[model samples]
Target: MTDRTVTVAEAGESAVLDVLSGEPADVGDDPVGNGDDAAVLGPAAATVVTTDMLVEGTHFRLDVTNWSDLGRRAVAQNVSDVLAMGADCTRILVALAVPGHTTMADIADLSEGIHGEAARSGALVVGGDLTRADVVVVGITAIGTLPYGHAPVRLDGARPGDRIGLTGLPGCSAAGLALLLDGRGDGPLQQAHRVPTTPIGSGAAARRAGATSLTDVSDGLLRDLAALARASGVAADLDGGALPVHPDLRQAAADLGATDIDARVLDWMLDGGEDHGLLGTFPPGVDVPPEFTIIGRVRAGEPGLVTLDGVPRIPGGWDSARGAN
Candidate 1:
């Protein structure tokens, strides 16, 4: 009997790191390059590191998206994660894999996009590598530092009576994605699909306002809220009437035969992902910032349960592997 062996690609930076390091290992401190946005020495104030990947078809579509937009979206999403951790992003390291058929101009445009978005977040592209591949794949790793001795607001801290706050409106990205897939031409929906404007500074703002728990809305509100519930050992009940939906999305949903606007909006709000807004929990007496709206409350219950209008959550939104099917 012959044993099957898996051979990883050696062309791209991530692939090289995977092959050499194996299993995405992280070494906190190193005298040399350390593979982080910046070198680390001993323990300083606070440091946070996050990495994310965007595949060509899974995370984006090249047909309607420009190279620059793709680049910006990739970087913005990763930086959003860092901010969700209550840290300010300082630098990023990017790794790109391009197919042989890809042109230098395409690669340059992608670089320009990455730099452009990074600059907006007050972060710099310190180092990166590029190589040939069968398709385009972008990986970004961001590093940030928190204030001295300030503990990051993790998901586990949400108490039974905590008030839930959200930074911005939801469903625009999901609605936009639906529009693009439905063969709708370029418009606001397409624009949402192209570039996601994340709430960059709101994470720190939430932290300063005494947020007990914090997370970014990446994997739909329900899925991510479920995570927060599990982490905090509680139940999340969202006010159906309070969920804000974009007007254009409602019109678009109606055109697409989605009769119940609430369901459609809930699908986008609870199930839709990639809004990049901060969802956080605050103490009962704490005053949430003006930018945040009270959407719900956290209560003591079995871990990993989320309720919409007082019932178990149903799936009708985005899943990366499922591709909105």
Candidate 2:
């Protein structure tokens, strides 16, 4: 036997599909699972569908992130989308495009990452497609279900006197990216950049806590909040001092030689994307969930306006066309 690296081209399309499929358990007990032409999900009061695509050189760099982390990040981001709408993720469909020279080991790692994340989110990898491309592209579509009694949360639900809250730290991922770009060092922040984690059940919790409006911080906090405010026809005022800054993130700023540490940390918190934290508005007089910290309040003002500490601030975040932050 020859010890040779098996490339995707050598394995052919059939074998590539098999590797991506993982195991029959990956599909759970769906009526039609992996290897089938299509998937059949159970009935629900309503269905939620969201799609996200990550391109090779754009969304990620192959040298920095392994296939496993890339796979996990792809699924986690999409799952956060469905959860933001106050729905339970039940199934997902993946579509991959990779160059022929890609190694089979990389494909297997990618598949394992996808399956692991799906299981953690209580979702099934029912079906997907694999094909050849000049660059690697991973596209995933997540499906969520809302039960009869629960209503799907909307971006337009915020009103005057509502309280703004956040579930997780915002700047960790951005700090991680900054370190990676500067070739600083490895730590939790860098890992955060590689494999960002979402607050898995926070969306449903916010809904039960009477969240008037909800969104995930896939983009920067200010940008996502501004969009939500625009949809709700209200203005958001964030308390600059109240915004929780991660201790590690602060240390990262100092390590990077930031003259003004607070400013740099604030920049990451407001402008960093991909932390996958949940942001929502709760009606005044309602006790917000403990998982969330009250950071701001909603008031009547110019629609889509976002301010930090009573002063109007510009919204800055990741814009796909504009490139990485």
For all predictions, the C-alpha RMSD in Å is: 7.8, 1.9
lDDT of 2 by residue, 78-197 (tens): 999998998878887899999999988889889899989988999988889888999999999999888788898899999999999998888999999889888865788988888878
Backbone steric clashes in candidate 1, count: 0
Q: Give the CA lDDT, 0 to 100, for residue 142 in model 1.
A: 85
Residue pairs in candidate 1 whose N, alpha carbon or C atoms collide under 3 angstroms: none
lDDT of 1 by residue, 231-270 (tens): 9889888887887766787788887789797677667767
Off by over 4 Å in 2: 1-4, 26-29
Predicted structure 2: lDDT: 0.88
